[model samples]
Structures are given as structure tokens and as C-alpha cells.
Target: MALTIKEENQFKYIDEGAGEVLLLLHGLFGALSNWEGVVNHFKSNYRVVIPLLPIYDMPLKKAGLDGLNSFVEDFVKLKALNQMTLIGNSLGGHVGLIYTLNNPDKVKNLVLTGSSGLFENSMGGSFPKRGSYEYIKERVAYTFYDPETATKELVDEVFETTKSIPKCLRIVAIAKSAQRHNMAKEIPKIQHPTLLVWGLNDTITPPLVGHEFNKLIPNSELHFIDKCCHAPMMERPEKFNKILSEFLETRPNDS
Candidate 1:
């Protein structure tokens, strides 16, 4: 039978590579395509699995308000997932953290990059004041260390993707829904070896949040990538891949 796991919603994904499994999850408005570079690099030596989150190519409502939790349940049904390594970005990172906390037995290592699920009010917090184009623009601008890197093409792509979502309110609604997960209390529950990656110029989640996570999550190491932004895997594939490879080298066998 083909590699497949059933959850509440039928999602698309990639299950390639061999040896210890490494599950990758992407952020909002992201799909399996987000980790194309990372998956290509590790597929030779590791079993890389990328789940196409429900919100991709669809409206936020389609992903379900509790989609994150539902996705984790789907992962549990995958018999190959026992004691595997997990790497997630943005919203995916948040879900990873939650999974690790509730089902530590399924995770050997956790890697969160420009992660979310923390900062209860980050998207709506006082910083940017939430739900405004200015907030989105400022957050996007802050994600990159070099503002010049925010090319018009990139900005337009983001806007277009958000517009495609039904009702066009999933962006804010997802952010609001994520606030229910309090990382501050959950951080202590994550005991597996963890690696936190941050983009120095990140404005959306900010580098300071990474530092905060490092301090709160015991036995976790933080790596700061200068000249990078929100999506390091896409912006600096070489460096991001190298860092991930090095981290995996030191971890105990996932088997």
C-alpha cells in the first residue's frame, strides 16, 4: 500500500527519502512547496515528509479552525512516525511545538524556524496593532534584515495568495485562532532535543522571540541567520540546509 495516513481532512503531502523520518510543516499560506529546497537536500539520507496544510490553495475555513490539532492527529496515525524528528516554520512550528508537548513519544528532535505558536498576541499585539495592511507590510518588511530584499514581486505574491482565500479573512482569523495556544506554558513541556532557528532581520516573529524561546525551552540551542528573513529555507537555502544537516548529525538516532 502507498504511504498514507487518514485524518479529518484529506491533505496533500510528500513522503520521500529514507532512514530516520524528518517531518516538515509549513506556515500559513504555505504548502508542501515551501520546503522544496530542504526536502531535496535531505531526501538522499533522510525520510523527509511534507504535509500540504489544508489552507493551501483554499480558503481558511476549509482548513478548519482547529486544523493544527487535527493535523497532529493525522500524524499519529502514521506508524512510521514513531520517534521521528520534526521541523516546522511559522504556524507549522507552532503545531509542531504543540504536538511535541502532547505526544513527546512521537518526536526525537524538534526544529522550529521563525516559528509561531508563541507570542499569544504577536500578530494582533500592540507592536503592529493587527488587522491592517500596514501591519502586514510592516511585518513583512521586518522579516527581512535588508528591506531592499522585499521585492515588489514577493509582496505581490503574498497579497495574491491571501486574496485567493475565501472570504479573504482567513489570514486574520488564523492568527486569532492561534492565540489560544499559549507557548509560554507549553514551552516547558517540550523536553526533546530542540533547535531554534531565527532570521536576524525577521520582523513578523522577530529574533527576540527566538531568544525568548531559547530561554524558556530548556536544552534548546538557537542559531541566528543574518541577512535572512521569514523563510530562510527559500531565501538562504544553502545556509539553512547546512544548519539543519549539522543539527541532525548531532541528534540521537530517530529509530
Candidate 2:
């Protein structure tokens, strides 16, 4: 039986630590394992719950997009999470955005790193559409500043996740959702204090997107990390930790 939820798309979760609740959602091609470096930092001060997104296993027959929606619903329902802080990276960031928009009162703070919800506005060039292999190639290249930083291991990991059944379904679901899902309209309505963290050299989402988010969302703050690319948490954990800790600690009250 699944420890977290009853859905067919099972998630491996680490339900440890205590204090204020901090739910971490990973981006596309990412799992809870990716957040290992950051979880410990928050463990002592918060109840850190890292949910492994539906990437590897496929338990349901529904479209991957609906499955994701279900995943979020199940997560919120399974635990009485209130006044919690939600943090997401990459595709996970996109998910977090939607989660907050839907359940604004549930989230006290929002943190998105190198998120991927905005339209194509790259300083380098336009991104390829979602389906083609060239699109994947360009996205991979765009996510990093230094080409050499895109190690073979990273490439292989990316490919493995994309080629999987669950991920493919998820891609289709998110793409469909993105075409019509414009959080821009609801941005002004989001009352949670938000932190938008972006890599200055990020070509995928670009710093402009973060700025746009900051401008649209009422109480949002943007922090740009120079000399970094798409994955700021992974590219520079020390800085990421410092910024994150400061934000969570200074949130006035649990609200």
C-alpha cells in the first residue's frame, strides 16, 4: 500500500522534521531526491515534507495533467496543511503556483526557483515547442549558462525522465494546461507573500519572467542569483539556503 496517498501514481515521501510545515515539490524530470541538500537545512526548524512527483510510475489511466491535479488535491486533503510555506523548482515551481492560486488561504508563503510558467521570452532566443526532440535539446542548452556545465550525467538524467511513461503524460498535461492557464489574471489576487528566485543567466524562464511575476503579484519579492543557471538550488545550494532561511524566518507570523 502507498504510505502517502491511495492514487495509482505513488510518491516516495520523507515525512520527518517538525515545526511549521514546508512542502517541497520538484520540477519535471526531478524527484524528492533532488532536494536532499536543502531539506536538512530546513529540517530542524520545519516539518519538511518532500513529495516525489509522479515521474517514474504510472498507476492511473487518466491524462498526466489530470493526474497532477489529483496529486495536488490528494496532498492537501491527506494532511491538514494550513498557513504552510510551499516551495517549488522548475516545473515544480509551476505546480506550486497553481497550487497557491487554487488554495490561496492555505499557503502563507510562496517560493519559486527558476520556475517555468511564463511565456517564451528568452534573452537568448525563443524556446522550442514542447514535443520535438529539438525542443528538448534547446531547453537543455537554454537552462544552463556554461555549456560545459551540462554534464553527461545531467543529460542522461534528463533523457531518462523525459523518455519515461509518466513524464511524457505529465508533459502533455502541463502543456495543455499552460496554453489556457494564465495565472497572470489571478496574480493580483494572490495574497501570500511570495519570493521569486531566478538565475540571472537562465535562458529557459529568464530573469524577466521573475520580474514580471514580481510586478504582477501584490506582495512578491525577486532575487537574482548571478553566475547561475536553471537549477539555482543545485547550482548554488549555500546561497539558496541562506536566502530561503531568511525568508521563512522573517514571515512575521504563521498567519
Candidate 3:
């Protein structure tokens, strides 16, 4: 079950189970369900919250880094979440980083996958034509090393969600802003224990970026998955979950 908290907090989210909170944030053009497999694995052990980020569905209110951060803060406060283990992918990772920096006391640990806000600004892709099946197929293919992982149902679902040109344009704008963002300097300020996961075959953010993150973020670790792409959780759920389980289960937190 879900309920709207605030005007700025337009995230479609899921909150379930008990114990410590697992706050899952999705990437651009992604919804809450993107982390379904991961959430299911951890829900029994921890309360899970996977929010459908506002980037996927354009809200009447304009969104930026500040707005996104505010939305997350409100969501957390509304739910009275504490000692959260934040796990985000792609753009969601970028947002989570910003939030943790501002509210470090609320978070116990962090995990980012195929996250944006690294060195590069431009997201390379042949968008083809908007609202077309071919465009969806190309995007799905581009995100995964093995195109076969993006099943027809998944592609079709993305297509239906992203059919509107105006919405797509908003997403493009959000992506552009994400690309322009340079969190290199701010990332080091984060003192929370962090785990960086990346796909070896990921062309979107690339595996090298994970290494860079490991260096910049003091309390951080990096894990590489072979034959995977940007969406590791979706493409290789079992392996991704195992690595995440080890990190979340055993990592010692200062708090």
C-alpha cells in the first residue's frame, strides 16, 4: 500500500516488512518495480521502500537536484525512517548520494549501481524516434550487455510508460542535468559506508567509473560483474543480490 505525502513528493513508493529500512531508488526512465527482485530478497529481513522516481512520470512541478532531494527527505521523514540502507541505480544513485550528504545521520550504509554523476555528462544512445517500439528496443538493448535479457514484456512495458513525447523530453532534460552534475568533490564528504557495483560490459557508466568512485568515496567498496550492463539488478539478479547481501549483512557501520 502507498499514499501521497506532499506535493513535491510525487514518488510512487512501496513500504513493507519490518526492521531496518531498505530505501531503493530507481534510475531514469525507471519505476519502483525495477528493484522488485532485490526488494523481495530483503523485505523479510528489512523494511523495503522502492520509490518510482518522478523522472519516469513527469509531475506538474519541475524537478531538479534540490527538488529530488527534498522529495526523498520528505518521504523519509513522513515514514520516520532511520538508519536506512540506501540502494540506488543510475540516476537514483546520484540522488541518493546527494541525500546522504545532506542527512548522513539518517543513513547506515549506501549502495549504488550503474549510477550517474561521475566524470562524463553525455549519455550515448540512438534514441531513434520517440514513442516507437524500435526506440524502446534500442534503449533496452543499449542498457544490457546481453540484449536477450530485456524480454518482450519488459520492452513493451517501458514503451507504454514512455510513449508521451513531452514526458520523454522531460526525461531527456533530467538526463542532461544529471550529465552536467559533477559530484566528484562532494562525494568525498560522504562518511557513510558505501558499496559500488558495476557491470563489466556497461557502456553507459562503464566499470572504470566504479573504480573512480571507490577512490573518491573514503568508506566505499567496488564490485564488478562480468557480462552485465547498466542494469545489473535486472539483468543478473541472483549474483547482484548475493553481493549486496554480503555487503549489507556484514558491513560495520559507525552509527
Model 1 scores worst on lDDT over the 10 consecutive residues at 120-129
RMSD of each: 4.8, 4.8, 3.4
lDDT of 2 by residue, 1-255 (tens): 122322333445766578888888886656565677677677787888877776445454653444665687687677667778899887777778888878878888999887766653332122224345555665566667766656666666666656655555555555555544556776787788898888898776788888998998888889998988887887777888889988877788643
Ranked by lDDT, top first: 3, 1, 2
Cα lDDT listed for each candidate: 0.72, 0.71, 0.79
- Residue 13 error for model 2, in Å? 1.5
Between candidates 2 and 3, which one is better according to lDDT? 3
Say which candidate scores most in lDDT: 3
Residues forming the 10-long window of minimal summed lDDT in candidate 3: 1-10
Residue lDDT tens for model 3, 1-255: 222222334445787678878899888767666777887788787888876666644453555566677778888887788999999888889999999999999999999999987853333222446677886787777888999877898888878767766666666667666777789989999898898999998888888899989999999999999999898998889999999999987965434
Model 3: what TM-score?
0.89
Could you give candidate 1's per-residue lDDT for residues 34-123 as a string of tens digits?
A: 687887888899988877665543446644336666666575575446778889888888888877877788789999998886662244
Clashes of 1: 2
TM-scores for the candidates: 0.80, 0.81, 0.89
What is the Cα-based lDDT of residue 98 in candidate 2?
80
